[model samples]
Target: MPDPTATQALGRFVAGSDWRDIPAALRHEAKRSILNHVGCALGTARDPAVQAALRVMRGLGGAPAATVFGQGARLDPMGAAFVNAVASNLLDYDDTHLDTVIHPAAPVAPPLFALAEQRGLPGAAVLHAFLLGGEVACRIGNAVSPGHYARGWHITSTCGAFGAAAGCAGLLGLSAEQVAHAIGIASSEAAGTVENLPNAAKNVSVGNAARHGILAAMFAAEGYDAAPAAIEGPLGWARAAGDAADVAAITEGLGTRWEIGRNTYKPYPAGIVFHAVIDACLELRARLDAPPEAIAAVTVAGDALLLARGDRAVRNARDSRVSIHHSAALGLLRGRAGVADFEQPAVDDPALAGFRAKVTAALDAALPRGAARVTVRLANGREEETTVLTPRGSEARPLTDAELEAKYHENAALGGCADRAAAQIAAIWGLEEAADLGHLTALLA
Candidate 1:
């Protein structure tokens, strides 16, 4: 292969990793991320944002090559991957690699699925590629890290394009050099911004990442070459987009320490950082006897990361889903932050806003990323406090298979497909044994 830059190493792994030799825990984590992403995609497939996007895409239709999950229309492979990715991320309920805050599966799995379905690939291949892609994405993400993220780059899209392309390249059984070219080609188009998170644009970024990956691999398959040092060269992706790269994070321990093994799913639809706040508020709610009106204030103390992403005013459901205020309000008033709790009706509800105004988030340098302390002060002169060191779904407190299955059902129901959810769940759990991709395609609709 070309010079041993970061992308080439990642490409080699993507193209050459043996599925049979992958550790069981890493494989399970891959399945967990897959199950989480599939549920998220199904739930939001018919959402307004997706509907609008579908309309535009259908108007500019290409070959009917691949199915858009939860929709009848089959779009071109790229278009299908893009729409499926958007649907997966629309709810912001997918899994997250907390170290980089990148939702790995959203971008990687969509292209893998789209390409696999079009090629009639088996579930095992899709599953293996998905995991491999996630590893590549997260490692690249780890290299640029807080610097890339703090600089307003949406690491999921920026780093994910590489992962998506790498995975798709592997799924297509491309050579290591071809995989390297795919990674390099994707580097040229990597982008997304933190400013778009509260709007449909965020999903567009994710979708674009998925589409760009497929296109990158397609171009590479045709012998197109990217700059050899596309990812780590002085003027390449890392230097251009991020302040610095931790080379060690990207190059150390290839298959031994899998990044996907550290993935965490969201129990709430909101940003993962606010999950601890949700946990805290729900715990405080349990200790209260008075009505919502009796609560004078709710204070949430967490890492500075919480304030960076979660502390925001919620004018609509889009804003509400990423707002700590809504998370707190839902937990205190409704005792849960389900998918429906972040709906338009909830955003417009006066009581929700009133409850929101009482909640405040304070930056605490001492607390870990997933930990938070919530205190509620009541008009009755009572106070209750709860600290969640490990919110549910964190690797430290992973959701049980039963809990994850419940999550799948809840999400699948949102797309009005509860009737098919059970079967879909069964298929995903038994994905390795599946004979073909037909069952997955059918479930999407």
Candidate 2:
């Protein structure tokens, strides 16, 4: 169990770079990711869950260090990061990286926004830090591969710890050595379990990752000590999580190969893995005009992994995300799935129950990750079938820029900032000239 050479190389690379050194493509991707995060955050701003968390945060009020997006209240960096990160993930609509299966924005954006406000930093700097963080998270995710996620650990919390540290380290202007220490410190603090799937606690994992990362960076900046080989050490992250660690993937194109380009946006509000099935169901619904009662049975065949890897025993809405039966049922009954699809009334609706009872899912041992085959049996003894090779909004069939913007606006409106957030976000993109992050922060308020 010697140190992993590849993980060590990645640490060195992460520890060495400055924001100015990131490439142009990476920068552009970073901006898009930022926009995506802001949109999702605004969408969840007014959610009861987010509001409840905000109220608790407000009561524990500390120094006014940074602003909470859409809430307009300032909190200490750690608290602000926690609340904002939770809000971004409240609706499960944040951007994700396929390689690591990590929700990139959930952990990256909160720290960047909080630090920007604390340091009076401009939008450009915040955006750069975000890109760097996403790159680090995705690379680490790739290094670990399907192993990390399959091990019952949530990627957004595990790989994301390092991402949060990188963003905070960049903003704090820590030296490479200090950044390395921060990475090491953050590694030890990482903890999340997939067992929390579809729970309000699921979103808490993301917020905790962001908050802990900030703490790790702050500690390193103040002369904290951590094992230099934390990532690559015999018992480090790779050995513990990755099936067969690929360190080269971690450091191969540092500062050049942007992981941000590989990031995917969610078109539907369910798990990324279930998007194709939902798409297939929606397409079938469009072609057939019948109510849920007219359906005899609905069958979905896709990556067996969905049925195999997913937790089928759903007790609540959050649990519904990982349940193929639940997602497919919602798709057939309502012709769509969203945050509202998993609500109590929706989940308990008699029509939805009838549809759910008719829905049968099996893993297509042959289908690929982004593909699915769905069959609907009509009460009239007629049957329809459709196969989706790739869901919309995936890199295989990306959403148009206009579609992306529309998604942002739609989510922003949900978070209670639909009217002005988009325009303000545009201004923030030109943040190199802005004096403070207040103008943008106020939009969330």
Candidate 3:
């Protein structure tokens, strides 16, 4: 028999998946992904970008059917999804699939929650939808990666639409044919570029991914249709955006193996490539005989992708999050690499600014994408160096459930929702058994 088309195969997989068929371990991982996603969104709910999105959404009003997290107001499902997607991704601190560098949860989870709340769906349904959507995004990321990202497509924002559509379609109980149409529709909506990574424009693209996914699924549910090969045909998304899509990448072990299983959460609010740089610098800091201020020079070496993504001038907080020099300084000088370390104030701090100048980056092709080597030369005639291949929060060195909870609490405090953190935590932890999302959505607001 001939192989099925990419979109059709994906549609069928999503439509056919059962919550009971998913292993307990995968479900737990999905819960972790959702938990981390919510914390990241809540962490930046009051951020300038999020505020701007919320204000715009309020002006362009729709039915108040879903919660806009961290704010008291509710908006239509699309509006809520848009605002929440921006908030979760604005910090660049969300979960990552290392191979594709796609922040899967940011674009996928918002729509799932928004639709669940709007439809009064069970939390288990939301969780199941999130898992399938996140998996679809990562798999599509795999199909177009390396070249696609190298060609400047923002993998998360571009592939996220497909995940969003597939997940939302499942929640809507669309048939396989409808799900395929949803995926095909999402192909037209998929957009966002790596060139816009250092500014708020990037967040807008993520917002669009969430909003458009819902739009695609909604349209498909209404009997909208698209060409069957909308994703992999010569004129389709894969070839149109990049060199080509790897059919094997999208279809191999489609449902049995999970890409969400490979997901990694962030410990620092910086690009995942820079985590190893931070880890190495933190280690070198411990071994240095002199104070960080006494250090005359710092060197960071990593793969070409790291230098490509992080070797840049930091003009603001957004730039700082992707700046290798800034990450090195935070670990060496501040001894911590938290959200505050990447804020505008931190960017403008004279001490950090001066220290950033002391740091330099170079390429070592031998090093892995998330790996880094750091060398610090001090004025006291002492030098210290270290290498970190698997930084904290990586799948190999996963954050403990307790550590993840601490992160959630810290994010809640940062978003001024500390008073509600405990209840939010309880709701998320008990999500699978909940009747509906009302309790969780209320706490998010």
Predictions in order: lDDT: 0.86, 0.77, 0.91
lDDT tens digits by residue: candidate 2, 1-445: 7743543454456656666776666666677777777788877777788887777777875787988887767888888888888888766677877656688888878888888888888877787777777777888888887777777888888888888997788777777777778888888888788777667777678888998889998998999967766776788766766665676777787777788678888887767778888888888888888876777888888775577545375566666666677777777778778777876777677777666666777867788776778899998999999998878878788766677788887877776677885676676565655677878777666
TM-score order of candidates, top first: 3, 1, 2
- Sorted on lDDT, highest at the top, how do the candidates line up? 3, 1, 2
- Give one clash count per candidate, in the order shown: 1, 5, 0
Error of 3 at 71 (Å): 0.2
Q: Pick by lDDT: which candidate is best?
A: 3
What would the per-residue lDDT of candidate 1 be over residues 239-349, giving only the tens digit for each residue?
A: 999765677798799888888888888899988888988888887777787787899998888887888888888888889877888898999898888888999999998
lDDT per residue, candidate 3, 283-353, as tens digits? 88777756877899998999999999998998999899999999999999999999999999999999999
Error of 1 at 319 (Å): 1.3
Model 1 lowest lDDT segment of ten: 1-10
Pairing residues by index, what is the TM-score of model 3?
0.98
